[model samples]
Structures are given as C-alpha cells and as structure tokens.
Target: MAATVNIRRDVRDSFYRYKMPVLLTKIEGKGNGIKTVFPNMADVARALNRPASYPTKYFGCELGAQATFNDDTERYIVNGAHDQNRMRELLDGFIDRFVLCQSCKNPETELLVSRDGYITADCKACGYHGDIDMRHKLTTFISKNPPKKAGKKGKKGAAGADSIAGQPGQVDGVEDEDNDDDELTRKIREGAEKVMTEEEAARLIAEREKADDWAEEDTSPEAMARRMAALGVSADSSLLAGDGDDDDEAAGPYGEFAAWVSEQKGQDANGLSAAELYKEADARGVTKKPHRLLPVLFPALFDEKVNAELPKYLPVLAKLNTSEKTVKALGGGIEKLVEAYPDTIKAVPKILMTLYQADVMDEDAIRHFATHVSKKYVSKDLSKKVRKAADPILQWLDEADSEEEDEESESE
Candidate 1:
C-alpha cells in the first residue's frame, strides 16, 4: 500500500467548515428517503412548510416525518424526500477517516455477520469477520493524530529537515532557509497563538460566544462594529460576514470541503449543502456530528463500492434488481420494491422485516433509516410502481386487527 499522507488536519479543518450547526442538525435528523415515505409531492411540500431554512427545503426536514430501516438492504427509507447522493459524502468521510477494519476496507457482503457492538471488521469480499479493537485507544488517538499515511515533504525533501536533535553550536549545513515561503512561519505563529492554556481559551471562548449571540440579536451596525473590533476584527472584518468571498487557504482541509460538497451535490447520497444538512439533522434531533448506518447492512454497503462512487450508488439502489453477478442478488421484486411492497408479497418487504421484528423502530431509528434509503434506495424510474406495490400492504398492516388498538385505548 502506498504510504497514506496524513491530511487528517487538512480534512478535519476543511470538511463542512462553512456549514452551520443548525442546518447540519436538520440534514441528519430528517434522514434521507422522503419520496418513498410520502409519494405525494403535495403532502411532502405541506410538511416542509419551513421558513426557508436551508435544511427544510434542500435536505428534507418536514414536520411529521416517519422513516424506517430495512433489514435486508440494511438501509433507511423515508416517507418523503430522496437524496442518496448527498448522504454518501458524509459516510465516506466518516468511514475512511474513522473505521479501520481490513475486511471492512475490502468488505464482502454475501453472508450473515454479527453487528451487536462486536469489534469484528466486516469483510467486503466474503463477509469475513475482522477484529475490532474498541478497548484500544487507537481509534480515539487517531482523532487527535488521525489515520494518515505520511506528512508532506518539507522544502528540504525529508533530508535532515528541522529535527529537534541538532547540536547546540553546529549548523546542519542543510537547505537554504531564505527560499521558504512566509506561510511556514505564519503557520507556526498561528499554531502557537491558538495554543493557549486550555482554561484561558475556554473562558475567552465562552465570553466570545456570549458576545456572538448578542450580536446576532442586535441590529445596530455601530454596535456590531464595536463587537467586531473587540474580537480583534478589522473595520472591513471578514469573519463578521463569514469571510464572504475571501477564502482562507490556511483553514486547511476544510478549505476545499465546501466546494467538494457543492460539486458533489445531486451526485452523492445525503447530498446536501453544509447548511442544509445541519438544519435537517437539527429538526430531526440527530447528530450534527457524523453518523453511523447501523447493524450489518451499512457495514456491508460500506464495502460494496469505492469511497468516490458510494455517493453515486445510494440514490439509485431500491430499483436495483436481480443481478446474479452479485451474490446478494435482490429478487425481481426489488425493482418493483416501492410499488410491490406494502401490498402484494409481504406486509413489509423482506428488507424491512427486521426492524419491526426486532421492535427497535423508534423515531431516531426511523430517521436514520429513512436517510439511508432517500439517498440510496428510491429510484425516480420505479418510484410510482414501488408505492403502488407498497402502500396497500402498509395500509393493511396499519388496519391489522382493526380497532384492536382503539378498544385497548378506550379501555384504558
């Protein structure tokens, strides 16, 4: 394997830095597959009567969302919305950076595997199990250092670069220092400046946050300007306007993540703007941080495709039909899924059998599950057919033993 370059800091600072916390909350919370959950656009539109919040309109967070996970596909499906292409971006960033299982690295999803908090890596080839080192601090340590290959070569080309072991009076007779870019020194200074005592920084940040909140609610430009000045901002302060067009190249990895998300929109699952994603996650009450796909299927789906392509596959998967070429061949019913399910064959598709069976289909569960499908399962092509196939079954199940719940509630 090529020595991986540790862009850990780079990616960490870069990904979704421009995204707001509130918007990101909405993206994760509303989950993904909205179209399937609410086939009627009018119904979906009514639920999404939000005040132009980026997430409510773009990433699918309406008032009354009800999503569920499918046991077979191990993905989420929602009552409205579909944005598989966007979701994958979030997952790829998470898995590539965080999960480190060799089998999961090359996952095989043909067979059954355990996912009940076991540390086994999911094999991408034959579903073989790899060991999980949950107890070890490796994963946690990686958060600080991050799993990376190697650092970029400095100007000296790794040839006796700035090593701390230099002798007191000896010049290492190395590369000329004059040719180095000013950024090198600037970065060093910035790092030192930012590295204040933890307590001091905390107190300062608390005070600043309080000021920021006050500024948000305040309308006077003079007052805002004074607040900005206090925060060490210039009169034409950039951070106040969120840096507008002036890009901070030194923001590191986060520098390119916004552009990446924009370019990746519509092409990846969970495909959302940083603002929209956080908004959805907020409304749905899920993590503004990255998320997991749960149980065995996500780990399986995680393996079946490349990191780049995974974003593309999810939005088109529910329509995925029998492909014996692939071992986990979904039946003919798959393409007919949304239409065939909740009607003809089973009350729920084999895909969703596990959720209700396990009795773990709560709100949060449904939200994540819905996100998975909206991004991965619903296909525009098979959409109507799928609903026609599914709604009746769902209706039957809802009315199963009619008034049973009514009588029970009445007695209570």
Candidate 2:
C-alpha cells in the first residue's frame, strides 16, 4: 500500500496538487513471451483522466512491442520485461503528450475529437485549447476507439429485472399489463421534467423575444470603426483582422509584425520561405527594439523542431540587449509558444545555448532569467521543464567563471 505521489515530481512545492497511484507492475511469463502486467492501471488512468487503453497502447508504441487490455478481467499487459523505472519514465512521456494540458500543464483536461479527425485537449484550468500531436501512434488508436459514454439503458434494464424478481407470486395477464403501463407513465414524467426546467423555459422565452433587438444593431464599417476606436486600435489592427492576408500592412511596426505572424500561424517553418517580414522590420527601424517584436517573430519563425533553425535567427535576436526588460519580454514570448506546442521545450536548451554563444545573453542575464517563475508563461511543472532545458548552458557558464577566476588569481 504505497502512498500516492505527485504525477510530476519536478514540481516539488507542497501546494502542487496533482497525484496518481504509484505504478504497480508484475512481471509474468518467460522468454520471448514475457509481459509486464499493470494491476492498478485502471486506478492510474482514472487519476490521469484518460482511458486506461491509451497509456497501455502508448507503452507498446514506445517500446516497439504488443500491448493488450482485457476489459472483462481488468488486466493490462505489455509484451516486454519493462522494469518499473522504465515504465515510469514512459508513463511520464505519455502524461506529457496526452494527459497534461499543453498550456497550464494541468491534468484537468478533456480530449476532444474534431470532425476533421484531429484530437485536441480542452483545458478547464486555463481555458487553453491546443491540438494534440497526430504523429503519435496512440492518436490513431484513440481516434478509432473513442471512449464510450455510459448509457442509462443498463440501469433501466437492471431496475426492471429487480422489480420482476421481487414478485414471487404469479401474476395474471391483466395485472402484468397494468404494471407495464405504470412504468411507462413514470418514465414519461421523468423525461418531461428533464426536458425543460421552469427556469430554463423562462430564459429561452426571454432570449427569443430579444433576438429581434439584437439583429437591429448596425454591422456597417463605420460602426465597426467606432468600436475599434473605443478599444484604442486602428481599424486595420492585427487583432481585428482575420487569418487570410499576409501582405496587408498595419499602421505601426508592432501591428504590422502581428499581422505577419497571424498569417503564419498554422504554417510550418518552411512556409517562412522569404525573409520579407524581417526585411520590412529592418526598413522600418523596428529591429532596434527586438524585444517588442519577439512575441510575433518567435512563433512565426520557429516550429516544434526549432533547434536546427535556431542558429539562423541568432543574428537577429543578437541585436536585443540582455537587460531585465528585454529578457522578461523574450521569456514571455517563449512561454506563449511553449503553451501552444509543449514539445517545443525539447529545443529550448539549444536555443538558449545559441543565444549565449551569439552574445545575445551573458551569464548574469541567463541566471536572472532562470530565477524568476511566472504563471503567465506556463505552470510550475512546465516552468521546471524550461529550467531543466537551460541547465546545460548554466553549467557551462559556471565552469567558464571558475576558469576566469583561476586565471585572475594567477595574474595577481
């Protein structure tokens, strides 16, 4: 009987609330037929708020083995001699990919399969909606066999069976017919009550009456311009523009950069084929304040696998200072990108290293950036991931400092 532990151990704070059952595994069979059995998988999956089958299938996919779960027997098996440590590590990967919300890293999320056959996690904690990586084999399995909803028919059938079993005495045809009628009437009344509560019915009537009034408001360009003025942005603000055109220019540099970013939202890194946006920014002198432009540039320029292309952007990011204000802004932009694509965390270390090598950040600036934790960027667990990614660069900086101090002492 092991105590429950936090699902993410990196989040060491006492207030960190998410927990799951300690993995319980038993190795059975022998030789090539060896399989790892998860006796408490149902409990574990229940805590994670995902179907048990998902993690089971994920184990097979990651290990390159077969997995099976018996619904009737409550058994989960993976065809391998996976140790508890290995299984735990794989389970964390599964949680990162499937269970946790990409934005807040909270387990309070629901899996939604869109009409286009894409899976997304709708987070309740942060109101963030992000698409799941369709590249994973588990995504296909989930799409093919979505979790079944519980039905009321089973309970109704059980209730009827119990009612019949209670009557030991034999009943005539007329009495049986009367019982059926009574049951039908009861069900009808229950359904009718559920269909429209008094409060709900009243609200519906009020909304219908006001629908005409709502339709009368002007939707012309002049009215829209007035509303935009009230919000303190031009009519051509990127926030108001839809995701269609890329060439449409905005009134200011910030707005223009935002408009370009919106055009590249759903596109891949290759789609950023031309350096037109960068050239335009340079022409307009927006390159001087790279920190202000970071929010738009980072997302548009890089994809999930950003490490390979990260060096190409270094010359641009180098123009920005390593001051507190600039670092804070850059951190905020990076956090927003991570929220939308959690996998981007994998490339963060390389990105930081590149920035340091290019003189965009010094040891002091990197240390200052790492010490602060903000929920605006990501949750505690994800913030830990970012810190973990930056550890290599931090270590390098520490070693360099030690070497410098040694050299200074020798000179003295």
Top-scoring candidate (TM-score): 2
Candidate 1's error at 92, in angstroms? 42
TM-score of each: 0.18, 0.38
Q: Evaluate all candidate structures by whole-model CA lDDT and list the values in order.
A: 0.27, 0.57
Model 2: residues with Cα > 4 Å off, grouped in runs: 149-412
Q: Write the per-residue lDDT of candidate 1 for residues 54-149, one digit (tens) a residue.
A: 122222223244544332442333455333334323323433322323542321111122334333444332345654444533333223322122
The global Cα lDDT (0 to 1) of model 2 is: 0.57
For candidate 1, which ten residues in a row score worst on lDDT? 16-25
